[model samples]
Target: MIHGCRAIKRADCFHSKGHRNPCRSSSNPYMILFGAVEIAFSQIPDFDQIWWLSIVAAAMSFTYATIGLSLGIAQTVANGGFRGSLTGVSVAAGVSPAQKVWRSLQAFGDISFAYSYAYILIEIQDTIRAPPPSEAAVMKRATMVSVATTTFFYMMCGCLGYAAFGAAAPDNLLTGFGFYEPFWLLDVANAAIVVHLVGAYQVFVQPLFAFVEARAAARWPGSRFLAREVRVGPFALSVFRLTWRTAFVCLTTVAAMLLPFFGDVVGLLGAISFWPLTVYFPVEMYIKQHGVRRWSTRWVCLQTLSAACFLVSVAGAVGSTAGVVGAVKLHRPFSGY
Candidate 1:
């Protein structure tokens, strides 16, 4: 209890130091509660398909990261481990100080932004390895290249989607592929998403497994015989081998099966998870690593920019009101019902 209290106090001190107004710091949670209602109210739709809009944004976000962000992460910390991974990885991956990344993430909070946090770990691991200015410059170039690529794709896709569907495109993306054969395109998109979701899990589920396995290994002394005997490796692969993974797959399946039942809600849940990492914590880290005294005008601009991103994220999350408006236009609602 005493330790926990100290940790909290330390965290508070860190937040206070970063900004003149810590409370004003934009965060994802604060957005969901505050904006979702107002945005929902304002975006009241009758001619637009709100649900589809939400999905579009979700896809673009994924596109930006998967194609570029993923590369950025790999380049940043290809050989890095959590925490200390950032110094070398950031240089490799194209990031600046923990403080800089913190500024860049000024948008909606999410795990994507936070995981880059492995940079702080770098500092924790070693003072000497903390990145130099030259390393920081390299990272900036990588980010620029990735952002340009991502932006092009995002705009083209969004535009294609809009043109292909006219009024219908937002509700159905496949329409972009074949406006004349939207049904088939829609079916294809649906099938592809099924495969994508399965693949997404395969891609995403590993970290959790490793985390559990590491814990199990740490306690191996308590069950040395079994630990040594089992080559199945880490956190009862059995849990995921059948039930948990299948259950997870099934939940998405069921949601899709009952798209009318809970699809939009699930997306909201998935998207919102990014908040804790991106919006709040990045700022939290920036302040802690460098006091307000250390910040430059450029850093201040970037930090403010990230906060705007957070607001846009809030708009995206809550703008489902806007999303629903789109659905009403389609009269084939995807969500926001």
Candidate 2:
């Protein structure tokens, strides 16, 4: 959300002051605004209620992605060919050999972040209604389709973005001033990102809200504060949910304000969650649910895959942590890069 705001502000600034002007924007206001918006949306009863939001988010995602891909293609064509080398950003480009290695490892975390959504798969699956086909079958097919589509877009955006800008590519293609001439289009892309994130924030945090509320309701079954909901126009407002979700949003907002290195934070989270949430637990659950025999070929293969993913995740964590450390050294708290 902060990055989206920055991009929007940059677009406006660049439009008024020309692209060559060094336009700097702070992320504090946007972060607070995002938190406020989320706090209001958090009141929506549960995961099932946010179906429209998820759809809008998906559309916004594709909107920005398509715009970015088109822009990259245009830039590449203008350049007359691909600009990057297979060797990637060279040491001669002022990057040290060790920095190169850390970045390479960090790329794993970014990719992991891109593909990792298993944490919310169960929540999403729960929202699916029963039909002629089983929910499991529907979810399986949906997952496959989503993965294939995501992979295609990732490849296209990544390759084309690299081909266009080479080593000079911005950390964020849309916000990084990679394409400056199409100011209105950039604004639309950034707006789409903000809108997507607005919906996505609720989607991701709904599961967390559910878990906490469920546990609290179980512990204090008789407590009105935890279980009771009051009528408010068309919505039944829960005091407990309101307070808890609002506090969570505020806390996270403050955290974002303090550490605004979006890419580094994303990498760290991806690294931390990819192995356990996405790979290890899912693999174990599948084996347990299906009663796969220990040391059997299928079991061995799954275990091997989990082990390999764990190593990759660890490397990503280390690299991402290093990136965070370097960023912190260069930036003060609440300072937007």
Candidate 3:
């Protein structure tokens, strides 16, 4: 969202001023504004209730992605041919061989992060009613469709963006200021991103909210702070939920302010969470649930897949951590990157 806001601002500035003016700005204010919006949304009870928000989020996701893809295609056409090399960013004067290797590994983290929706698959599956078709079947179809569509857009946008900008491509395709002429369109794309992220933030954190609140209620079953609700106008509001969720949002907001390097943070998070949440746990659970014979062909294949993903996760973590360290050394906390 901070990036989105920055992009919008940059677009506006570049439109008014010349492109060479270097219209820099701070992301802290936008970060705070986003936090404030999230605090309000956090009050909503859980996943089942925010179906509309999820729908809107999905739509906004498509809106911005389409805009970005279109822009990339246009830029590539203007260039008259594809630009980037298959090996990726070249070994320039400032870029060392080790740095290039780390960046290549970091790209794995980015790809893993892009497909990390598996973390919430079961939560989504739980929302379906018992069916003429079983919940498993519904989820299987849904997973396949969602993953395929997402992968398609990811590949199109990534490949096109690379073709357009080559080694100079920005970490964020839209916010990277690649297309400066279409100012209003850029603004719309960034605005859509902000909207998309607003809902996405809540979607991702709701599980954590539920987990913490559930544990609190279990630990102190009789406490009013944990269990009591007060009427706020026509709505029933839980005191504990409000307080705890607010604190959690504030803490995370502060962390974001401290570490404002979006690319590195995202890569690091994807590296850290991808394997355990998306691969190992799910694969292990499937093997256990289905009673697959140990060391059988099926089991071996699954184990091999898990092992490969684990290695990717490790390499990604190392590269992303290096990126973060390098960023921190170059810039101070709470300062604009």
lDDT (CA) per prediction: 0.38, 0.90, 0.89
Best by lDDT: 2
Residue pairs in candidate 3 whose N, alpha carbon or C atoms collide under 3 angstroms: none
Give per-model TM-scores: 0.43, 0.97, 0.97
Across 150-177, the per-residue lDDT of candidate 3 in tens digits comes to: 9999899999999999988878788988
What TM-score number comes out for model 3? 0.97
lDDT of 1 by residue, 1-337 (tens): 1111222333344444542423222222322332233222222211122334334434644543343222223333533432232122233445446423332232222223323323232222332233554545655574566557656654555444433333233222321121222233233343444333333333334344344456665776466442342223342323322333345444543343233322233334433544445445766677667665446785677578667655655643553333333344654332322
Cα lDDT tens digits for candidate 2, 1-337: 6788889888889989998899987788888899999989999879999999999999999999999999999999999999989999989898999999999889888988987799899999888888768889998999999999989988899989999999998887898888886889999999999999999898899999999999998898899777677888987889898888989999999899899888888998899899999999999999999999999999999999999999999999988999999989988887655
Model 1 root-mean-square deviation: 21.9
What lDDT score is found at residue 73 in candidate 2?
A: 98
lDDT of the structure predicted as candidate 3: 0.89
